[model samples]
Target: MMILVTGGARSGKSRHAEALIGDSSQVSVYRYLANP
Candidate 1:
């Protein structure tokens, strides 16, 4: 499964995602793709 979150900088998307997945002892690996 995968979730994609996108928004302007400092838009709190990350925080919201974390909150949505809170209280779960599951394993989640984050993959970051940086464009240079």
Candidate 2:
């Protein structure tokens, strides 16, 4: 399963995403992508 988090700046998307992943045991690996 995959979850995508998106929102305006400072919207806590990453924080919420981390919280979700932190509560899951099935997720063993994670990757972060960003544009430079």
Tell me the tens digit of each residue's lDDT in model 2 across 1-36: 888888887888878888888999895455566778
**TM-score of candidate 1 to 2 decimals:** 0.52
- The CA lDDT of each predicted structure is 0.68, 0.79
lDDT of 1 by residue, 14-35 (tens): 7867865674568775554445
Q: Each model's TM-score, in the order given?
A: 0.52, 0.69
Candidate 1 Cα outliers beyond 4 Å, as residue runs: 23-25, 31-36
* Stretches of model 2 off by over 4 angstroms after superposition: none
